[model samples]
Target: MPKPKIELHVHLEGTVRPALLADIAVGNGMAPPAPSPGRFADLHDFIVTWNATTGCLRTPTDYRIALLAYAEEAAGHGAVHIEPIVDAEPRLGLDGWADVLAACVDAAAEARERYGVSVGLTPQVFRGQDVGYAEEAARIAVRFAGRGVVGFGLSGAEGRHPTLPYARAVALARDGGLPFVPHAGEAAGPEAVREVLAMGAARIRHGVRAVDDPDLVTELVERGIVLDVCPTSNLRLRVADPGRPHPLTLLHHAGVRCSVSTDDPALFDITLSDEYAVAAGLGVDAASAYAAGLAGMLGTDTDRARLVRIGRAAFGGIDVGPAS
Candidate 1:
């Protein structure tokens, strides 16, 4: 059996199977974007493709189908727990955000029963939009906290919008006991990571660029903030060079906690296991990778304990040390 794992930084819309997207588009009397070379030309290209694909989801039923499909996919890859980011900008409308989130919660409950994979929803605000949108999304996330929504996140064009604008929204999430996890240090740089940190982010998604500043890396280590790093996404987005050593290895060796994830498995054409394989190739052993996953999960205590038991069984009771 494959070793059990936890995935903390995948996106629900990004997990829509290509065939499903085509099916949805055809049924809705819409034209599906033509298939392109699997790799993205740039971040803008990626965002465009991502938006087009997500646009196919028009109802709560559509969201549930996508959620359940992603659950099964992650479970097949040995993910015992997953936190899939859901962008709040509605394909249906602003009111439809509630329906989408409700569907996700229902699908997650069913997924746990069927696949034994615990699911958490992390609703994200598109940074390119106004901060009020973020505040709205954050309030929705806060309302659903512990129901299925486990955290709040900020995603999208990082360079186009600075993190400070969303501070109040992030603060609302923090005050409501939701883990604040925002995307940073990918399209931008280490300073972007710093901005999110100032907003009290418990974890950072794709914070691979923190390695650029030794001081920032040291601060990350000191804070025990986990980074959910997606290696293939970094390469596909051209944020990191494929030929060079990935920042994940450097961050791991520097004592910064890190977890391997497939940010968008379907979109990026990779898997959670594939990410672990890449990490292994870069000299990070399976035990260390699993250890990081355990430490980085945003699940509750019961869920964490379940993952710990699963990990202990799969890795032959190996000493999975503290993340730091």
Candidate 2:
């Protein structure tokens, strides 16, 4: 087996291959979404495609299939752990969330038994939503913390919606023993990253723009917040500067804990192994990020120890240092 690594950022809906989504849509008696282009025009285009595709998931079986397929592919990428962010669909009542969570939990158990892969589901609240829905997302996340949901994710257009409006939701999740891992510094600048940090973000999704601010970078180093960086996603969405090397290189060099990931593997057509290779080619220590992420996951100590042992057995000496 290849060196066991961890993918700390991915989207549950976006992980489903377009072809598979078409199949599910047909099975659900709905028309499939239009075939996506080679790359999206922008985040808005991506979200439109996302909603059209994921809207077909009407049953628990669809959710199970999505997660298991992702786990199978991730395992082939030498991934022993994956944290896939699931959108908190406002239409889903608490009952609907429970069914989806139940399906995911079963799929996670099967993945562990079948592929030796551990799965953590992170429920995401969109920044574009009102406080009521965001707070409900937090409540649902808290309600299912240990069963399968391991983290709380804040997503949506951070540039348009400031974190202040969603502070209470984040705080509720954090107080309920769920780690806050919000999307920041992608659609916005370093100031957006600071807002999430102020909300007690344990890990940030695509915080590459923090490199634009030296003080913010230093604060990240001092506070030990991991930025789950996805190079392909950044490049595809035009979030990273095309003229410069990927920011994970600079962030790692500056002592910011950055874990390479596939934000939306199927949508980006990138794998976790490919992402690690990209980071390594740019002189980032992906192995260290894996170690840190494994140690920092909300899983129990026993699970962390087992994952570390599996990684060390493959790659040898995965350093779990300050990155955790």
Candidate 3:
């Protein structure tokens, strides 16, 4: 049997393969956006590239296809659970985002029925983007609470924007019964992580830089906060020194709760399986990483228990359960 795996921080727009994007682009009678370069100079560079890559998506059907495609491919590679972030504003307004979420929810249902991959959608608010839109997304996510939306997140060039302005947005999401899981500690340093932690984030994406402050790391360990680490994405974005093992390895070794992810798998040319291997090579083994991923999921106890059962068989009898 294949190793059981869970993805904690993958973006929905970043999952569409070039071929899939081209197909959608051609179907819509528009030329596909230029291919993305393999490596980005920085997070700012990556964001610009990421936006260009999402130009192919113009309708809800395109979102449905992208969601289903990633679910199918990821499930084939042993991803038992995947939470995809969908946050493309301007290109999509609140109404369109709701449509995309509905389409993704229906598409996730199909993935569950056919591929058996448990997928939940996450709505993200860009840091410093309109607070009104951010609050609206939170309010909107409430309607899809158990249906498909599982988590709420903040994404942007963390260096350019502060997390303080979005506190209300995070509070709104939490009030709507969604977990606040935002991207931090990648483009910025430990302070960025602290800001989100203060906002009651359930888990953090790309929090490798928390290692810079040893005391902060201890606090994370004490709080059992899970930093969803993406080694490939980090190195590609230059957040992690390529010559060294990723910072999450240090955080993990120091007892910080760490989980593996592919922050933007297709955009980074990686899979959940590949990320697990990368972390393993950095001294974070698949079993522990997968276990942390499971523990960090936003699913209900009953949903998590069901996944634990699947994980046991998927990992060929390795057990990690009793999700709290």
Candidate 4:
């Protein structure tokens, strides 16, 4: 078996199996969205697909099924730990958030027993929505912290939606002792990455764009902020040129912490193992990848320590430094 890995940038909605989604949509008396060729034309097209797929999941049971399926698939890819972003937007309603979160927690517990993969939920505030909605999402996240949810995140179109307005929500997450992890530097640029840092982000999803500004890269290194980089997602979204080397290599060489992940694995048609393969292709050794993953995980210290031991044993007793 390959070394045990950790995935920190996955999305539950984005991991729904298309066949299951179609079945659920028909069962709900709703028309299923048309299937695409897997690769999207652009970020907007991808978001449209994402929204349509998530629309099929209307009940708490739907979320439970999706979470379990994601867990099984992630575990198959050798993921020992996964922190997936769960979006409970207008579809589930504010009051329904608790049920869905509880369902996820239950499903995750079952998945741990069945698949040996620890799951953590990170409820996201859609940045494209109004700031009030973000605040409400943060409150719900705070309410569920330590029960099932491990952190708070902001997702959506980063190009048009500035992360500054979500400051109140970020503050609330910080006050609740939840890690602040927001998407940045993918659809947007270095400035967007800077904004999330200002909001006290411990990790930045798809922060590969931070390589554009040397100063910001230095700041990320100095602060020990992890960039959860998804190579295939960047290639599929056209955020990075396929012909060029990925920014993960640049950031890692610059002493910025980075972890490989399969962002929207089902949507991007990739896997955690494939992501590790890509990292290896970029000259990242297994020990270094293990180190980055350990640093990037948002799980409890005990969980982190256990994974380190697993990785060390799996990879021939390689030293992985600290658990972070």
Give the whole-model CA lDDT for all candidates, comma-separated: 0.83, 0.81, 0.84, 0.83
Q: What's the true lDDT of residue 140 in model 3?
A: 80
Q: lDDT for model 3, please.
A: 0.84
For candidate 4, lDDT tens digit of each residue in 165-195? 8889888987997889889999888999998
Go through the candidates in order and give the clash count of each: 0, 0, 0, 0
| Reference-based TM-score, model 4 | 0.95
Please identify model 2 stretches exceeding 4 Å from their true place.
321-324
Model 3 regions lying over 4 Å from their true place: 314-319
Residue range 50-82, candidate 3, lDDT tens digits: 878886788899999998898888888788888
lDDT of 1 by residue, 186-279 (tens): 9999999998888888889989999999999999989888899888888888888878888888888999878888888878877788988887
Colliding pairs, model 3: none
Write down the TM-score of every candidate.
0.95, 0.94, 0.95, 0.95
- Model 2 gets an lDDT of 0.81
